[model samples]
Target: MLSDKERDQVRQTIEQQIAEAEKEMVVLKELTAAVAPDNSIGRISRMDAINNKSVNDAAYRNTRTRLKRLQNVLEKVDDKDYGLCMRCGKPIAFGRILILPEKRVCVSCSK
Candidate 1:
């Protein structure tokens, strides 16, 4: 269980993370834009560009998922079970929660 102060801290941290993730999503969306087929680049360079786009697309997806999880965690910040590990039903360490408020599992169960 977490005190009210700890919960507030986690809420603030999660909100900040959410804002950062949203900004990153916008940048990644630009990076993942379709590569023009008729570009004046060499074949190898075009291939490299395509590959980079694929990587950026994956990163964008991952960030989007994390953003959604953070939103969910923010909503649950005031709940009684907010800091409890989902795997073992133990209270997560306050330090760990401060660092990763979106995580639902503790260090022990995460292994």
Candidate 2:
């Protein structure tokens, strides 16, 4: 269980992370845009650009997933079991929750 103050702190941290993730998603969206086939770039350069776009597309998807998880966590912040690990039913460390509010399990269970 977490104290009121601790829960509040976790909520704020999660909110900050959400904002940062949203910003990163926007940047990644631009980076993942389709490479134009009609461009004058050499074959090798075009292939490299396509590869980079694929990487960025993966990153964008990951960021979007994280954003959704954070939003769900935000909604559960006031729940009595908010800080409890879903796997072990133990209270997750305050620092761990603050750093990764989207996680529903503790470090040990995550292994």
Where model 1 places Cα greater than 4 Å from the true spot, the runs are none
Q: Which one is best on TM-score?
A: 2
lDDT at position 52, candidate 2: 97
Residue 67 error for model 1, in Å?
0.5
lDDT of 2: 0.93
Tens-digit lDDT track for model 2 on 1-111? 999999889989999999999999989999988898956898999999999998999999999999999998899999999999999999998888988899999999999
Q: What is the lDDT, from 0 to 100, of the residue 105 in candidate 1? A: 96
Where does candidate 2 stray beyond 4 Å?
A: none
**Hey, what RMSD does candidate 1 come out at?**
1.0
